[model samples]
Target chain A: MPSEAQAAPDILSVELARIAQDIDSSFDLLLPVPDDPRRPLVEAMRYAAIGGGKRLRPLLLVATAEMHAVDRDTALRVACAIEAIHVYSLIHDDLPCMDDDDMRHGKPTVHRKFDEATAVLAGDALHAFAFEILSDPMTGGGDPFVRAELIYTLAMASGANGMAGGQMMDMMAESSRFDLPTVTRLQQLKTGALLGAAVEMGAILGRVVPEGRTHLRGFARDVGLAFQIADDLLDAEGDEVAAGKALRKDEAAGKETFLSLLGPQRARAQAEMLVEQAISHLASCGAEADILRALARYVVERDR
Target chain B: MPSEAQAAPDILSVELARIAQDIDSSFDLLLPVPDDPRRPLVEAMRYAAIGGGKRLRPLLLVATAEMHAVDRDTALRVACAIEAIHVYSLIHDDLPCMDDDDMRHGKPTVHRKFDEATAVLAGDALHAFAFEILSDPMTGGGDPFVRAELIYTLAMASGANGMAGGQMMDMMAESSRFDLPTVTRLQQLKTGALLGAAVEMGAILGRVVPEGRTHLRGFARDVGLAFQIADDLLDAEGDEVAAGKALRKDEAAGKETFLSLLGPQRARAQAEMLVEQAISHLASCGAEADILRALARYVVERDR
Candidate 1:
């Protein structure tokens, strides 16, 4: 057998692909299109949730759960829950009243494909479904306390002080100038909160003690920042076809981003440094954390 | 003291008024205006959640909880959670892309007062906050299992199969014709589900057995349908100023409604019949169910 160090990258890619397929099939079963009149909403939800994106959030969740030996079935459900939230956010963000983007993941956005009202309801339904999945006894875990904690954590991460708050800050940034600290805080709340929750949820599912989960929290924090920096970099210079969405819009809109503030080279270096710091936090976990380490690196290196 | 029948209506109106005031104050404490740039979102959330409406949903929740002798604090929290969901739905429903209404509760809609993006984020945040409230041990109840159950029940009531599904059906009704049964099913899912959840949550909080809760479910189902028919009646003939929203839009849009399907006189009679049936379901509970009975009659009697 190959050395653990040499085998880590292959395992990371293989595992990510495996979880992506797993989530796709799970969502298919979870959200079948109804024969009723409301099938449009269901179809929009399925289209937005299934069929696209890197599935990075779910991969992170499942990877962390694997480190703690959580059951695959339980891990997959939590993974799907997190992914559903992510997809819902993307759908809402793409709405004409929000980001006004017509394309997402190289296809027409939900509103573009199914109209605005359907898009709104689809996103709303997906948001509710995420909590449904987490709170359901079968999907969450055998322990009700764990399920309650998952619901609490996910709700906080997604609510006023977190993702929605960050989006508000981003919109405010369009008209108001924000310092680097303010922008950093915005990214931390908007994207970092949910990413952190994904890791925390996996730890919760594994029944990891609070003290033992501290390192994972630190890892998630660093990786979340690194992920945002990478996104800014991609928007600044990456190909639209490769990125699967509009690029350079931040520049066009004069929005303050890490790229605009730090320039490409410095921002790239900062993300790499953050990734290394993220990996270091997981060092005490030994080889069981290899996939998480790979994921931290993947966040910065991914093109889309 | 007056006999139970004579005292019920007075007690209900008084209790409802008390709970409405209590909820308004609690929301004030729960959602204070933030000092950050995202204050607008918080402001919008507070505006939608706090100072307005009949607080009927929360009253239903609190009154039902009162019937089971649940703690006031626990009942209040659940009341707030259900109200949060109700307010969020109203905010989203009034969006320019949806009902396109300018006024709600005799004031400018969230989108009209702020902006569409802010309105959307605010509504989304409120939805998240509802689950946050229900899953938090301090708020939901002392029991984690109860909190988990609350989350699951609320999610099921709010998601694709419930409110969102009903909203989709309502939108579809504008273009496609629906029979009476179809419209009734739509109303049941859209509005009935949440209303039913309010009573069920009260039962759950009281630790009432599922077998014991069946009567309450039937009560909620009948009252829910009656409530919607009254709404249709108000839309068809009530004063727009008193209704606090546009009136007769259903007719203008040629949408099918209980009033259109059954005619005004018959629809009014049906609502009253439903209320009678609703009260009959609670007969086993005796005087403890008086407030619920009063509320059922109030549904058809209210001008707005």
Candidate 2:
């Protein structure tokens, strides 16, 4: 494991921290608990939202935006919006009828911590809150059209074709063998869509013209594949101490994985290839691409 | 039932049918099945969306907009949006983990018709489609800022404190006796919020001033309450064939209802009184209010 000092430069620990602080500050206002009958439900929502996680989605947005030299503060609202959407998905995914997982991020899942009923509301609230924040034109000096576009994209990313679709495929694919193409499509929708949306939102916010948008999309696509493969590797090879949860649960459950399909060494090599391609997409942007490159490397290199 | 000839001068069946037709036409373009592997899932989504119902939410929106002299065509997009939100809630509520109902609008529930996983995705797709349609400013021809407000209100109404909150409460209250006050609150959040939002959207589109907004809100609040009470009465007294599904299921489940709390006769009396109050709010709007008045009557008068 990288020491604290080494981790600082090698990965996004510092950047992720700054982004978390920024997100917490904004949600602090929008999610204030009212003393109404639904107060407990709202409190449970706050608890689920404030739970510690990697803040990967938000960091991707910020980091990608930084690559275009866009104002990091300006992207803060979108970052928070993305995080809210992610948290909402997690809450719903943990419901009894879905993944049925009892623990997440080292704490009881939302439904386990609160009643399943409250967890449902908490997830719904966060889902609504994401759009509510995104649609507020005043906060981000947001263009109404742009805000609307952002909301539309975010909703789609979190909805059927993105996270939800990925989830359905994942559920259906359980105990079944999936070819590499099928697995790629599944991971692309399940995990890559939102990550791609993060990069797209950043580029959109930067007002990067048509060509830049294409480049960013390409970069995000490669990095997203790399990111998921690394996850598969970590789950196969790492321990719970480093990964923070059960590591080999996916394999035990017989879920398809990159390593299972390609072998560990091959999967690791493929991930490196993806990272190189991702970095190549940003070469035109010069020094602005530094953090994105670091992020791509960090994706494969991190223990978690 | 009132035949076309028996309809009141203010309540033209042709006009209502036209409005419903237009709303259905608008939704047609919003849920097209893409050629992705998720196409089957999207087809199921389209099925859930296209099935016939009263289209109450859209009717309320169009009628209220008519009252404000807003063009019915201009109101079509928002009306479709409200229906999307309403339908999404229904799909999710019917999931195995939630209410677990097997039938909706006389057809098999989404999970039974498609699969549980597909149903979940169809619901998620429809939910996102609502916001997408609403946020597209080109359709509404208004300042995007105004459209943003409409999107915000819709999200909140369908979200945690509104429809989703009520759903969660309904789930928790299963087989339990909730007092009149609690039931009233649930009705407001679940049914009333969307109805109120319909009226509010019309007012926003028509650019109602502050005083007019207040009047319209009061009008919607009373009408929304009346609508739910009438729903309870229908479940209590309407014919199963006429209602298009099993009747008194809510009563059978011991779900809270106005009739349960106040008895059938009293509930009918309460619904009628609310209709009167609803009309009184539109007292000054004259001819513009006629369609709305007819709709209010329809709420209490719907046989099914």
Candidate 3:
């Protein structure tokens, strides 16, 4: 709860590590490996969900919720729900038929660790687990309307018009010629929607309806674009070991990305500009908005 | 609706067709293909969802809803929601990583007709659409608690402990020696869970609490068992063309099924017994429950 301005440079890293751990624990609580034939599926889900990644999405939700005094426990539950969706997408995207990935977060992907069928089922179970967390009376907050709203919001963000939609566009990227605007549209749907949903969900838990979410939306939008530009840069120039996965996949797939279109210099400049714009969107707020501002800075500044 | 007792032997078929049409319409309404690059993904979802299959799950939900006097349009929404889950499961289960089936309901499976990545994204999108239908205020019934409850029920039935869990067990069937009890438990989670959710969702719309669902639960349990047993029988002896998919794969995989364990005679007898028991569970109700009774009989009698 220290003022972010006075905090160390790793304010974002400290918060990221803490939220990732909390979300991991929440996933553990949600995933009870049964003493039956289904144990492997649950284990795969647990493996994919826990002990990995930057946890940026959950951090976004948690940080926004904290700004409005939402209970930490409640915030964590919503955070985990969003993270579950994120994990499921990773597992599916890494499948042999999709990205054919072998490593994630310095470890074998789920399909490589387990079999392909097990990986598919595990991804599916985690997807359902996300909704289970949002709709459950316990951990999902006391308000029925809020719970339903959360379910609806996350569903919209994850459905045909959201994350899955973006993934579809990405899948098509390999075979088609894409320019800057098309790439931007694809990223907006693929990565941007979920990030925006994370921030919007936090505001929702604080009872801030859609009309009052203008500034938060602007903050989420700029940060989301910056995050994607940074990712493209990482793919282009960052070390695979540092990124904890295969890099330069965009070039290999012949997919045009922000870095490929704008070049490294322009892309980095665009990302930094976005970070500044995102922070400016919170100009009216106090130190409570510092965490969000720091996250905007971290989006472009982080190496991986 | 005619009294099931006085109707012809095709009573079940008539109602099944009607409900299938209604559910297809609902899916059409919910899925709006975009003009953007995401169109292929949505098109795949539509092709998988709109045509094909028995639509037995939707029939079960609609029949149960009608028995409780729920609105037909509202009932169809829930029907489509449950059907969406069933269809998504079929799409994923037919993937090369899973069953690797080539055909479903006389048409190429989603993964066969569409590219593998699009199939994966379509199935994922349809999965999200189920919760979207259940959580939306317009089609999700009036009460917020009811909406949340519906989502929780479906989520539980679809998660690791339910359909996906059962799928994990099935994946293991190729390697493990499963006894009759193990197979029963697996089927209960895989197919029984969703069937129970369908009936339970209907009762939920009628404001029937969990404690009041004892008899409905019994009805669903017996029908679900009969349904799976009939499925095993069909896989063992029915025509491949009529079944619209490969047959005898259970035996090919050396997996233990009810038909494999009991032989054709005992398996057929068992399904009939379950059908009668399932019908008996509705004995306390009047003519309104007749459709359910007929559907129960259909489980044992249908050829496909």
CA RMSD per model (angstroms): 2.3, 3.4, 2.5
Best-fitting candidate, measured by DockQ? 3
Which has the better DockQ: candidate 2, or candidate 3? 3
Residue-by-residue lDDT tens digits, candidate 3, A1-304: 5687566646676887889889889888878889988889999999999899999999999899999889989999999999999999999999989999999999999999998988889889999999998998975578998998888989999988889999999988898988999999899889999999999999999888889899999999999999999999988889888888998899999998999899999999999999999999999889998889999998887777
Report the Cα lDDT for residue A214, model 3. 97
lDDT of 1 by residue, B147-178 (tens): 88888889999999999999999999999999
TM-score of A-chain in each prediction?
0.96, 0.92, 0.96
Q: lDDT by residue for model 3 over B1-304, one digit each (tens)?
A: 5687566657676787888788788778789889988999999999999978888888888888888889888888888888899999999999998898999988999988988888888999999999989989875567898899889999999998899999999988889999999999999999999999999998888777789889899999999999999999888889999988888888999999888888899988999999888888887899999888988888778788
Q: What does the interface RMSD come to for each candidate? A: 0.6, 2.5, 0.6
Which candidate, 1 or 2, would have the higher DockQ against the true structure? 1
Question: Candidate 2: which pairs clash?
Answer: none
Q: Which stretch of 10 consecutive residues in model 1 chain A shows the poorest summed lDDT?
A: A4-13
Candidate 1, residues A1-304, lDDT tens digits: the string is 6798685768777877888899999999999898888999999999999989888888888888888889888899988888999999999999999999998999999999999989999999999999999989886557888888888889999999899999999999999889899999999999999999999999988889889899999999999999999999888878999988988888898899988888889999999999999999987888889889989999998888
Q: Candidate 2 or 3, higher TM-score?
A: 3
Q: Ranking by lDDT, best first? A: 1, 3, 2
Writing each residue's lDDT as its tens digit, candidate 2 over B1-304 gives 5586566544546666787677667766766666656676667777777756788778778777766677777888888888888887778777766667787778888888887757766776677778777767564566777778788888878877788777766665665678988888888998999999998888877777657687788888999999999998888778876776656678667677788889888998999999999989887787877778888888999887
**Each candidate structure's count of clashing pairs:** 0, 0, 0
